[model samples]
Target: NAVDLGAVLEQFSLVFCRLKFIFGPMALHALDLVDLRSVLHITSPCGRSTYQVTGSSGKTYTCYKSCHYCSCPAFIFSVLRKNDSMLCKHILAVYLSQAMGACQELSVSDQQMCDILLAKDG
Candidate 1:
């Protein structure tokens, strides 16, 4: 099950199958993040949505599902600059969480959501 990630395993099997079939190794990495409950789906009062995923290093990165963009350095360096990957693990995690309904959802005020968007990750 680990190799090729073929044959659905336990828990979120459908999402795992889809990710493995559609993405590559990073999809597997995303599953690890998902298992950690790293993905958070936030909805503002006005219905605007945002996502955040914690990386292995314990840093949370913002993810934009609409653009398949992430604030993680991996996304900037590998996906945008080096053109070595399609999406970062954080972005992949978000996708996996959404597909599996595994995300930890939060409801926040529009102002809070705006602050999250503008706030520096550091």
Candidate 2:
């Protein structure tokens, strides 16, 4: 006999909803990839290196190789979700791509976060 499973999933959804409500929404950055790249160029500690961010909005945002962080709500969400070191994929990509000039502090921070997660899991 087949059993209906919809109700079981509904309970999980309720739990998730409650978690979200308590957390007051997941942290997420709202900035576009283009603007994030620009900010990285202007604020990157390594000076400047030209790069381009092709946004889903079809507008290309140009900046230096140092661009990181979306400067958007997604950034916070990413952090809350622990999806990435930062909320913006562009920022994570920049860090991953620009190894030579990437921020050591960010690397350390990532390692620490990983360690914390691992410890919690174990």
**TM-score winner among the candidates?**
1
How does residue 1 of candidate 2 score in lDDT?
19
- The lDDT for every candidate, in the order shown, is 0.83, 0.39
Worst 10 residues of 1 by lDDT: 3-12
Candidate 1, overall lDDT?
A: 0.83
lDDT tens readout by residue for model 2, 1-122? 12457777788588657634543333112123323442222222333233334444544333234334343344457654666543354454344335434322222243343343231211
Write model 1 residue lDDT over 1-122, tens digit each, in one string: 38545554544587667778878788889989999999999889798888988889998888865788788888889999999788899887887788779999999999898877762563
> What RMSD does each model have against the real structure?
5.0, 15.4
TM-score for candidate 2, please give it: 0.26
Worst 10 residues of 2 by lDDT: 25-34
